[model samples]
Target: MTQHHQPAPAPAPAFAHAQDGTALAYQHRGQGPPLVLLAGQANDHHWWDGVREDFHTVRSTITLDLRGTGDSDKPEGPYSIDQFADDVVAVLNALGIERADVYGTSMGGRVAQSLAIRHPERIRRLVLGCTSPGGPHAVERDASVRRSLAQPDPQAVRRALADLMYSPHWQAAHPGPYRTLGDPRMPAHARRAHLIASNGHDAWSELPRVAAPTLILHGDQDRLTPPDNLPLLASRIPGARTHLFPGARHAYFEECREEAGTLVREFLLEEG
Candidate 1:
């Protein structure tokens, strides 16, 4: 017997406009409580391709490239975390979504924090993964990873990102994501602007002001943000909790999609 699988439901109202008139490209998938997915800094929407099916399976997810990456407008330099937050708001408004559960990874987590602090009413629950709360006190990655980000060639840049993002075993096990990971739309300057924006992101004082329930997820083997940052986030934000994934790196969600999805779904539904 030949059995055909049912096609997944599509998330409608794909495109949206940013406050600065930048045409932000976005896609919505699944159905339930609206969940906005913010990617890492300098990472396009495609970065979430591996684990998206898990999150989208139970709830509506809004995934978009934050201005400088992917198909989003790469206007000049001087981008800030606040600006990225506004871009998220623009997309939610365009979709007529009043509030949403937010899940952000790496630099995208910075954007989520800014949104929660700046626009508290817009978020239902916050999920931050493999990111840092920047400032003079913030712990940084190794110098080599920083240098890799500044590389002139995109291939080298991606290679550097992989080194900083994934554990060696994970890489050897799954090579397709990196092999096909290529985005020519992001210029070097735009990536620099993203790094610049991420600089001095001191949410230390502002985290206490975030009014939404929060969950912080991190990988034990993460080299970029370091697993130590997880405790800082959980302690700073009021009533925030954390989850640690052993043997996982920065891309913990993707590495452990099935488990992560169940945790997230339960949190959003039961906690929030």
Candidate 2:
């Protein structure tokens, strides 16, 4: 007997205009309490591909492409973290969502910090994964890891990223292709702008103002954003909690998606 599997529901895509009049692309998927998933530096909504399905089981996710990547407008540089947060607000407004839970990783986590700080009323719960507060207070990765990422060859850089993002055991168990650092579709200028914006993020002084309940997550083995940021975030964000994934790397949420997703869902659903 040939059994037929139902096709997965495609994301409903739409566009919203930021305060700067730049167009941002967003997709809505699943059905439940709203949750916004923000991408990392130079990445698009697809950055959540690895773990979105897990979250979708318990959430109605809204994912958007920040100004400089994917289906969004690629405007000129000097983008700020506040600007990225505002862009997210624009998308939420377009969807008529006043407040929602937020999950962000890497640069997205930085943006989430700005969002909760700058627009306090708009966030219900916050989850930050593998990200930092930046500025002088932040912990920087090792020089060797930095050098490996800065390699001139694109393939070499990707290989280095793969190692930083996944564990050897995970890689050995999964013999498929690995993910890249950023969106290949992003223009060079936009990527540079994203890097500058990401590097400029500094919310340490402002973290105490975040009104929403927050959860910080990271991989013990993460080298990209480094695992140190987890405690730093939890300590600064008032009443924030934390979780560390053992043997996982930068992509800990994906490497241990099931466990990560369960923690997130429970946190978001918990009473204030």
Candidate 3:
């Protein structure tokens, strides 16, 4: 009989906390200026696993699983963007960080915007990746997509993950990570809560209040938050700039991690 071999399992990430005692999870890597990364909706801190190595070349990186997701505490609904922003501040405080650059994606971008607006003292610079100001134009996800997300069917969830995260060619050539996105641990309630936070968010008027130097990154091929939205965001915030990644989708960071990290590192290092 032939001998069989099994692959070793990946090590699980670490956990931390916000000042409010809400359990939060995060993975820390690298060794320089701190850069706190807030991940997109329905995802965990591990979402940054692919890019963490790249970021370490420039600065220390911390990627947190926001409250109610991944290894974090799943406090009941009624969660708001403000609450999430506070969570970021609390985490910074708990870590004894006076200030750090912030990078957020999708829903995470909204939270980063809120942090800049409400807790400007904590943020040194801001990077908004594949996100939009929650307004009329931001409501671009198709009704069928919304319906499928609402149903909580396993197959539907898998398809939705692929549609949101990758281009057709990428999906066809590499489907493993996309399929793992439907891991049973991601509950319907968490998805609903994330949607509630995204839909209820209205940061358009608050854009002008963001004082930190900001960089808005958008994918030209992003279906969820269209590229047009990036200009609107750039125009509103003082000293805000925008970048469009060609042939990239909403998961621009995952698809172009090194390029994105390079852009972000250069932007954050710029002196005003």
Candidate 4:
């Protein structure tokens, strides 16, 4: 017999004040141990729209808009990954959450790195997906991939993003809810700031300091943050492990949502 589950409750919008007085926006939903979701570069909480439900059944999710995205304060940013991590800390403090499991993908994963490194006590277990450490030690995306992203035509850019995000087989068979791209509502300055923060991320020397158990996930076919970074992260972060979704691309969490969710759920809920 097929199983049917009721949808998770709607998230309540809330705000937390950062040290700089920025009113960061966030939402809390469901009931269970708290799990914080961080968005990728230039994105908002909506970045997880496609996969969040997979975890909501068992974990209370807290998702925040980084300083410049979603409803968060869009201050003039020369933002840093360290700063982004602090903003998450503010949200957690506001909610009285001392520690939570953190799952961050792409640029958000970079912020998660800083979070675990800088605020070690705030994370229970860490999940980094489809992201790089970002520095001289990290593998950079191919120049061709960079050129495709730099396309001037919007349609052309969309196509390029589609190619980067999903596998060819998946793209041919499915009409994707591709939430992998940056948020559209971002202003020019906010976008630039986000890009700067993402590019400037460098936690190579600090990964070993992350005390939380870490799981690094990625798609084997990922073009943006290549799967090469998976082992790099696994090797750097003490006791870190990795899982690669075969034939999947950048948005492997969405491409293989159920399986990925199960893997993460098992990892997060397991007894230490």
Candidate 5:
């Protein structure tokens, strides 16, 4: 049987002051146990639009723009994943939240790893979506992803993003969403900093320390983050669970949005 959930009300955007005085812009869409949604590099909280309503139906959905993206203050850096983790905790503290279910995708996942390892008490559950724990042993992006990221023109970048985001099947079934993801509004310097920070992420040594209930989601056909590297995450995170969407590409979260939400809902809510 198909499960149904009420759509979340319109999003309410707000700002929380991070420890370093960076103002992280976040949006709240529901009311319940905080379900924090972190976005990948270049993207912001709006990245969760496809799945937000589903999760929001049961949990208070908290979506935040990491340091350099969206409305968040973009300080010149030398940024690290740990700094991002600290920013997340600061946001929670500013909101008077003691504990919340955390969900991070792509680069956000790296930040999530640090959060789980460093501030276990702040997380009720952990969901790592299409992200990696970078280091020497990390899996690299495929040639296609490289080619896409290397595109020089805005049109070229858009085309590459569309290709990177959707599977052929998904694109054929749903037309506009994938094409609409214009490049994330980041200046050249800020973009470089985010990439640098992402490269500096090395949490393999720290994964074993995560204490929250964890779920790992990835795409089998993901060209950006090699799906083959996912097992290392699951094996290391105490009792972490994983789900790989077949034939799904980098934007598997959208390709499998409903399933992703259901899986998270089940894990967070312990639903039957």
Candidate 6:
């Protein structure tokens, strides 16, 4: 069967972060209230490149390359979701932001959840995209897929991940840009570290404690986390609302950028 796809959008501006004197790199754009973005495992802020402008239209957007990805420092092992959440807190602290809306995708979503659970006062609103409640059901990625990502050959890995990242229709519609964004030279150790931290995460038990208003977005066709995860996540977080896009995949933000941005803006505005 044939599928439909949306045209891809252009990239946004780049921003640098003096994260605790570490010089972390990020992308900043948009205007209005501050909205921080977190990327997925084995991906950097570049994952948001296509959707940053859309987000900026409604609110000031900040997208970061976490410690080990993009141009950020890739320190050795012992990486935990909580530690990554601290890195996010450091970014906000360095920028003198006491509180702001937070949006996280996949691993980034995990970080956002952790931040909300551990440091509730710092988050004004929360958006978890293409994410799962970290537990048994979440650790079901195909073995071959896991193996490829663990020790990926840059080019081959990018190609392999492309299939998992976007819907088939979206892939066909914007093949060039998707391929380019996926071509970064991610190391095996870094990928493994991220996977370990993400899979080891278990925040479902603590999610009900989050006080911030929350929004959960997921793609119906997302093979990575599966749409079922969205309901699970929303159920765990009190008062959390969810939106599932039909025919979308793991990169739902990119595939449905405009819709996603609109939903997020409306949710924040109504809740605030």
Per-residue lDDT over 212-244 for candidate 3, one digit per residue giving the tens place of the 0 to 100 score = 989999888887677787988898899888888
Total clashing pairs in model 6: 0
**For residues 175-216, could you state the per-residue lDDT of candidate 6 as single tens digits?**
666622331656767777887898888897899999999999
Note each model's CA RMSD in angstroms: 3.4, 3.1, 5.3, 1.8, 2.4, 4.5
* Tens-digit lDDT track of model 4 for 105-204: 9999999999999999999999999999999989999999999988889779878988888878788787865776778888889989999999999899
In model 1, the number of clashes is 0
Q: Give per-residue CA lDDT, model 1, range 19-105, as digits (tens).
A: 778988888877787899888877787777676766655687788877887777889979999999999999999989999999988
Clashing residue pair totals per candidate (backbone < 3 A) = 0, 0, 0, 0, 0, 0
Model 2 scores a TM of 0.95
Stretches of model 2 off by over 4 angstroms after superposition? 1-12
- CA lDDT for candidate 4: 0.89
Clashing pairs in 5: none
TM-score of each: 0.90, 0.95, 0.88, 0.95, 0.92, 0.86
Judged by TM-score relative to the true structure, which candidate is superior, 3 or 5? 5
Model 1: clashing residue pairs?
A: none
Clashing pairs in 2: none
* TM-score order of candidates, top first: 4, 2, 5, 1, 3, 6
lDDT values, one for every candidate: 0.81, 0.88, 0.76, 0.89, 0.81, 0.77
Candidate 1 off by > 4 Å:
1-13, 151-154, 179-182
* Model 2, CA-based lDDT: 0.88
Among all windows of 10 consecutive residues in model 5, the one with the lowest summed lDDT is 176-185
* Candidate 3 accuracy as lDDT: 0.76
Question: Pick by lDDT: which candidate is best?
Answer: 4
* Between candidates 4 and 5, the lDDT winner: 4
lDDT of candidate 5 over 63-102, digit per residue (tens): 8888888888888887788998899888898789999999
Cα lDDT of candidate 5 equals: 0.81
